[model samples]
Target: MSYCVGVDIGGTNTAIGLLDGERVAAKESIPTLAGEGPDSLFDRIAATVRGLLGRCGVPGDAITVGMGVPGFIDQEGGVALNSTNLRWRDVPVVARMRERLGVPVAIDNDVRMYVYGEALLGAGRGVRHVLGVTVGTGLAAALVSDGRLFYGGGSMAGELGHIPLESIPYRCGCGLTGCLETVASATGIARQARDLVERDGRASVLREWFPGEGMPGLTARDVSRAYDEGDAVAIEVLRRTGEQLGRGLAYAVTMYSPDVVLVGGGAAAAGERLLAPVREAMQRLLISDYWERISVVPAALGDEAGVIGSALYGRDAAAR
Candidate 1:
């Protein structure tokens, strides 16, 4: 009956949950406010965990904490190697949590924790050789084989989004010009839609949201909704996005040969609107052997995947 805290810390918000075994006993969220530095950020997270623990009626020493974060990580060292979104480098995350929270802490790249979550309890439940893709603000994938998430040398494995594409000159936020994330992620989706709309592909409803040079307010949700209305431009945008995402999946499938590819994150809410194209493109891009066995399904745990996965990972890390 041991309890634990699972933390999913992102650029904008941090999700903290108290779990008893497989169920989330309590959950809460707080802004990361990354510009304030890691100490301040961790301080707020510590406070939030305290609040959740109080609600769960659990004591400090009775539970552990696990965090899923972005960027390169020192899993063994518990330091965030570098996270440009949070402006962090070598931040002593484990040491800080141990001092303030008084519990064992486990940490890894957010997507790794995500796939592990799926491998254990969600879409990939009871399955080995799993691949997970989070297709939201950014794109990332993780590989799990025989119940273990693989972190390649330097903990830099599964960075599928940065796989560059030919002829895409748009400079990615990561300083690359052809990364898959430049066209397949939620940001990429919006960027593509806006670019097309501004380029006179505006016979669609997107023009109401983005008149000439009005890209500031354009978002992927806006585009998806338009696609639901059968707008040709939005359909074209998602078509390209799914095609790119499928291409990325094709490579991962060939390399890892996963049994399932769980597509998670916010944009996944598009469901078949997004995945059908991904499937279609993956079929075209992958070899017949890779295509027939792969099961590309949506992530089942939804928002709680991070929370539950981190908590369970924390519990296991503590035992080790």
Candidate 2:
């Protein structure tokens, strides 16, 4: 029997899944250890894939691999042009993976893979147009129209996180001041919470959560917990962050007019606390026709979406 392997490479962790047709048969995860560079990371991935197949008692014949990478990708060439999260540039990902695993490999932007999974098998199964946004350490989005992923002319579309927001004062890692991700991503939320407690001298449980100078070890999850306790500062931070994100999404909705907008990622786990404001703000900016028809909701597949999408994509690529 043939099998398809899906790999989702993230800045913090890498998730892998093995699929027998449409059903996932096995899964594994490991630290990406990105600082060690691409060669080291791929070595680990190859070993893990071998071990996974061995433990599952499956022969490695007729196997194909699909990968979801975070950043710009050269789809036809199978090269990672640039990945801010992985600190990768001009890496020959397909050639290296094929050498290590001895199988056909396919790749695409991670967010696009996530949207693909949702569009075909999860929340967006029947939707004609789906807009998927992930608010993790950073933010990005993908569009799936009529069951097909849309890659604009250069395969760099849906970079919503980099849209400039002049009102924001923070400098983005991309070297721009006031980029949307600086205020709307997981890291962005934590940064804003830290600034409020540290710079504004705000009275918040966040201070107690991360005591001492600069509130070392603070994270977006901490802010979400504080929001649960009704911390005024936490509420304000999420509200403002969601408002800005919604504003940015308003333009996307105006342009794409998706049937539904699926929001996923670590920060999205805050659920309604973040999405409520996102919906409110987005609707506030759009006219009745746009607001009335669109639904901004949480993604259904969770973390596995990328893996499933990648595997499915690989299966298709192999067939072609």
Candidate 3:
């Protein structure tokens, strides 16, 4: 049987998987330590993929490779323009990979890859149109229509996180202020929790989680745990978070009117804690005619979404 390889590079971890169709033939994950820069990071990925292929007894000619990276990617050109998380600027990722892996390679924005996995194997299966939203350290979205990902003129079509939030006025890594990213990302939620502590000194489980340590140490998981324990402050933080994300999804719903909207990524781990409010807020923001027509569901593939999607992406590239 033929096989393909998929790699999902995140701020902290890089996941690699070998697939024989939908069955994962082998998998591995390693630290990206992205701060070390792209060359070092790519070196790690190449080594890991080489090992995985060897372990699976797969040849380079029998496998295509696909990769998902954050930030603006010139997928067709095989270049990564600007990946804020990786601190990358105009890097030739695909060309570099071809030099190392000796196989056909395809690349796309991480979130789009996640959504493609969803469209093919998870929540969006059989759906003709899909809107995929990912809430992790950052927020982003991708649109898939008639079973294909959409890239607008600039390959920046789904930058929902950069749009300004009315009340927030903080600078984002993207060099913008008051972005919806400030209120909706995992980092954004932690930032809000920190602001609440500074502004009101209000008592909540978050105070216990942080103590005198201050804001930088706070995390979205900590907030989720605090919320689970019925901390009013954590509850408020997530409520605001879900609502903001819901509004973003609402706008997407109104415009794309997709068959389904799939929510994924780390923050989505909060499950009902995040999705409930998102659904409620989306319903509140959308007109009655549109609210019931659109479906919003959690992404089912979790960490594997990007991997599977990437492999599938590569397979598609080879076909073309």
Q: Which predicted model would earn the best lDDT?
A: 2
Task: Write model 2 residue lDDT over 1-320, tens digit each, in one string.
Answer: 35889999999999999988778889999999999999999999998889878988877756789999988999889999999889999999999999998888999989889889888888788899999999988899899998778889899889899998878999988898899999999999999998999999999998987888988889889999999999999999999999999998998899999999999888999899999999999989998899999888899988899999998878777777
lDDT of 1 by residue, 249-284 (tens): 998898989988889988888788899999999999
Which candidate, 2 or 3, would have the higher lDDT against the true structure? 2
Candidate 1 stretches greater than 4 Å from native: none
In model 3, which runs have C-alpha deviations exceeding 4 angstroms? 35-37
What is the TM-score of each predicted model, taking all chains together? 0.95, 0.94, 0.94
Top-TM-score candidate index: 1
**Pairs of colliding residues, candidate 2:** none
- Across 162-277, the per-residue lDDT of candidate 3 in tens digits comes to 88877777898768888888889889888888888767787887876677656657889988999989988889999999998898889888888888898998888888998999
Global CA lDDT of candidate 2, please?
0.90
In candidate 1, where is summed lDDT lowest over 10 consecutive residues? 208-217
